[model samples]
Target: MTDAPQTNAPEPPPRHIESAALLQGAREIVIEHAGQCYRLLVTKNDKLILQK
Candidate 1:
């Protein structure tokens, strides 16, 4: 019996962002997409939440 060859999936590119630079002391940021507005918020737990 012959063994099958193994293949690995391609990896995605890395992304980097400086949160302080984007937020700048703001708790929330407004995003416009497809003519709609959404809110990206930073929670007290230092996590992010997005809402429409």
Candidate 2:
């Protein structure tokens, strides 16, 4: 009997965010946390900003 070679690659965790969900005609979203409203925005420079 022959043994198979072992690989060192690790599996990545599952995440919900993707390009189609976040980049399709969307720029900002609202979030409610601890009874406070937060604005999650995508800036003109392609950066994410969170503000209350």
Question: Largest TM-score belongs to which candidate?
Answer: 1
Q: How many clashing residue pairs appear in each of the predictions shown?
A: 0, 0
Shift of residue 43 alpha carbon in model 1, Å:
0.7
What TM-score does model 2 achieve against the real structure? 0.54
Residue-level lDDT tens digits of model 2 in 9-42? 9978888787447656678887789999998788
Candidate 1 residue 28 Cα shift, in angstroms, is 0.6
The digit string of per-residue lDDT tens for model 1 on 1-52 reads 9999876977778878887877899999998999999998999999999999
Cα deviation of 29, candidate 1, in Å: 0.9
Give the 10-residue window scoring lowest on summed lDDT in candidate 1. Answer: 6-15
| Clash pairs detected, candidate 1 | none
